[model samples]
Target: MGFLSSLLGIIGFGIGLPIGLLVGFFFFVYSKPKQVQDPVVRPLEECDTTVLPDLLPEIPIWVKDPDYERAICREIRRQAEPILAEYSEKYKIKAIEFENLDLGTLPPTINGIRVYETNEKELVMEPVIKWAGNPNIILVLKLLSLQITLQLVDLQVFFAPRMTLKPLVPTFPCFANILVSLMERPHVDFGMKVLGGDIMSIPGLYQFIQVVRAFKLMKADFLGLSDPYVKLNLTGESLPGKKTTIKKKTLNPEWNENFKFVVREHQSQALQIQVFDWDKVGGDDRLGMQLVPLKLVTPHETKEFNLDLLKHTNISVHNDKKYRGTIVLELTYAPFREDSTSALSAKFDQMDSIIYRSSSNETLSKAGLLSVLVEAAEDLEGERHNNPYALILFRGEQKKTKLLRKTRNPLWNEEFQFALEEPPLLDKIRIEVLSKRTGIRFRSKESLGHVEINLDDVVRNGRINQKYHLINSKNGQLHVEIEWTMV
Candidate 1:
């Protein structure tokens, strides 16, 4: 009876253990939570590390508010003020004022934006930004007695990567990422100039002319005894060609015509002379021609040319060995000199007596102080807009007046001083009125008019307050006063 009972208990234990294992497996599978995901958003910095981003994200709706615009302006000023302070501290300029900053042609806007993926590491955006507007930036800088106004429009700004933001200055941090991306490409071009114009632009100096006095041409025409004339032309110059009167029925014709040409740039100038035979029925026949360069002649020296005329192919005469004709002319060149147009000639008309007086005594030579007072100007040339300013140059030193905006007339009552070691008789002062172009892409200076004042007249009169006419212009006059004091 005991053995029978043990067998039945073992069978029951095995069945119970198997059932317990099955129940625990089903519970583990049903109780665990399912894996879930949330939507992802990436900032501009999260663009792919290996690939460059081609799209810009849309601006948020909040950025379009007027309050945001004001904030941006405030931030720009706050950043710029410290930089300007550094410049002022350098002492190159005395004081500076940052007056106004406003939107230019086009405003800022954003099109749209989108995000994808669960990694929160990448995003694609479509941003529309048209930075077309005239941003007004009025900068007033005080240097000496001059009050200069620099109007900067359409300001383009950029930021470099790894730049640090100073403390206490409010800024838009989002722009930092955008500006950094822009650093990958070049944006601006820098240029520098040492001098304004050529040496001919100096005051008091003059350019003389080269005069050619032609006499006659001998046997110029290939055909026998043809009516001939001489024509003088300036190669590479726009001046009218000079011609001699036609001599009827003569192989050797005499002209006695004088032709003069200004020697502006001597190296690029040449004289061309052509002899032509007159015809009653058909076109005139070419006899011969010769070209002479202006650089071969010395200044203030007279030279003679009896050149043999040749054809366009450099051939004198194809059939006749003695078909050559010579042209006789006297060439004289008078170049610029310091005393050429100097008013000193008018002041010391009796140069011989003055030289004798100076040799007699050296005590008459005394140093003095020179004063120039610039008053105003009127009838300046302009079309669309004009920002006129005055530039004064003396002995290679230069100074400027404040800019006057949008006017045909400008007033600048300014004073300047110079200490002379010698007499002011030899010096000349140049004053140029220029119009400043404020366009962002087109920044240049247009000359309104200019005047050169000889100091000899000012020294002789002690003080000269008069209106001077502008050069190379029909209208415009400048008022100025000069005084010389013996110190």
Candidate 2:
């Protein structure tokens, strides 16, 4: 009797479970809410325009800010089609075109614009852009044997960018260049659908989108529509300034060039940058110029500048009206070592004591090393064969460089050292360029050019790198670097 009752109970439970499940499914499918309202629809022509004012309170905070401005969505959509088509072609697609492209009526908003007030001739503004747009952009792509449709929906982007309009002038469209850079990583969110199925809805795909969307903003800077080169030098020095290679026939050129200069007094010295448009026939035109004071930079640290190009160093009301573009560069100042600085200080103190004790008419002498580096000679023409060499003559001591055979421009890069008991303040060094022929000619040797350089400036400035014109030769120049270091 007990076994039969248990079997009957199990059979009744199995039958009731299915019946209950079917009843619940039926109610769930047929159930209706207690409250139901139909969505209101209106025709586009009959829509009331005055209702926009009532909806102002529901707008975003960026829309209410006075500094915020709406982005031109229509123009952006128009310009993006060709760029997208080009990108599709790059991927070897047979045909790709935008069937529907609209950024929608709700444009991207600038949260706020912060303008900086600086003494320099640049206008800097930082704008925060926040966009949560309902865009309908669809692209139709045709591969070799297949066609696909892609749709973009529910897009959002947020970023802060620094915009700079440099060298403000009085003319129309006052700024010469516009530079844009991202301040931080951008945030982008969107939904992408392919063939009526959302591909972005796949698991673990959003993380990849995050990485792909992180990118930098491109700068809108412009250069002169000519060949451009840069000359960099330190002020108060007669050095042959360092030069960058010329870029040909390009309005926008990039020269990631580096240079170093010997700084005597960082407090008073300044860096001068001169940009010129290269011309093969005549003199190069002056594109722009700027001066950066060394005192503004901290030693041992690198600093960057986007300096606005100017007519000259002397800033005036009239010159401010000229727009000469801009230059971007990095500068670093490295001072002498601690031991060298202490040794230099002791030498200066000893010189001061000697000046106080000695008579004013007596000559003061200090032991130092004089280094003369003959780099090269340019445009050297000898009356005979042009196998050129350089001769350096100091206080009755002469040093000569290796003779290079048959070259108008010879690079010797030779260094000569002279241990001197006194600075060559009142003295002069004579450098002569002479050529010797290998075979017997009318004259075996001939003088190309010679120059006599005074040593007063080198003694005062510690170093001088300059190209001096030859005294007797036409269109000849000698490159020399002289350094006076305390022993």
Candidate 3:
């Protein structure tokens, strides 16, 4: 009897729960308030100016923030089409066109702003931004015989970024430079629809979106023993290649080095990466090499590659089987700016009267200004007195720096300039460090060390900052910076 009573009670409770839910849902759907009023719309002139301040707290923050100004979506779309077309041509896409682009009336909101005060020529602020927008942006892509349509919907983003306006001036813009930096990883959410079906809802596709969103925040091998170093250069260039420091006695070495090169012709140029085994007493041995064509890299985009090293760039049946090793690299190419290119052209045109042409079909480069800076010297020593000064000689001109007395390390920070009618492609500059005796001595001045550098690399590469080991000196080095600018 007790079991039957418990079973009956359980049935009654289960039945009553659904009935109560139905009654509550019915009231929630059908109930109306005692007082209801339609919203009133008025013109701006009729609204009281004094009451506007009271409604500030009730209005949305995005509407009141100056940073949340409405964007001209039509102008943005017009400007973006040409850039998209350029990228499409680079990737060999048949066609890429915008089907529809409307960045709705909504704008990003600034939740908070923090300003920093410093005794410098800069203004810094950090703003927390949140944006949930309904934008209709559709893209149509064609590849060979296939055509694809992509639609973006329900986009959201949240980020905190620091902005800096530096070196305030009395000019129109007031700031010389504006810098923007992210404090942390940004959160982005969006839905992509392809062919009117939501692709984000598909299995495994959502993970791809997460992977791409996370990407926004964005090697070696050896035989028994080797001290590996890498040399990087662009092919078809006359300048010397950049190199990494040697890692000693390791089977696997990681030289996380950064290098920049001026690329004149991206379609014909290739980056040559060569690895070598450094030796203390003898010449370095070539370990392996690889070539990365510049055309394969998109401008201003970083791409990673784990490439297999080869004996030479000529890949053959024999070279394919050789297991040299693999190299990991991040490559980015930036195209030359139009203003700089035009300025260089104008300089060349101005120096056309002085341009020299040889009988061997060789033409001299245009005139350029050469700058030499004697920064400092390290570990320099003299026999008599360590009162060291630097003497710079270029062509027929000579310059000298102030002598520092009784110091093994001296910082001159002196700069010298040379005006020339043509590039010094085959010329060389000599820098000698000499020490002068303060008191009476047999020899007033003595040579500490001297170095001669060829100007070919400086002219080709535009600028070079290097520490050169002094000739005929033990553990002495000279720091120098050279810059060549077309006049």
lDDT of 1 by residue, 194-303 (tens): 11111111111112233233333444345646787777776776545667888887766556655445444566677787878787778887777778887777765777
Candidate RMSDs in order: 22.9, 35.8, 31.4
Cα deviation in Å at residue 156, candidate 1?
A: 27
The Cα local distance difference test for each model comes to: 0.59, 0.67, 0.68
Give the best candidate by TM-score.
3
The residue pairs that clash in candidate 2, if any, are: none
For residue 151, model 2's alpha carbon misses the true position, in angstroms, by 84
TM-scores for candidates 1 onward, in order: 0.30, 0.30, 0.31
Alpha carbon RMSD to native, model 2: 35.8
**Candidate 2 lDDT score at position 134:** 78
Model 1 weakest lDDT span, ten residues long:
196-205
Higher-ranked by TM-score: 2 or 3: 3
**Stretches of candidate 3 exceeding 4 Å from the true structure:** 1-71, 119-123, 143-146, 159-189, 196-275, 278-487
lDDT of 1: 0.59
Cα displacement (Å) at residue 448, model 2: 13
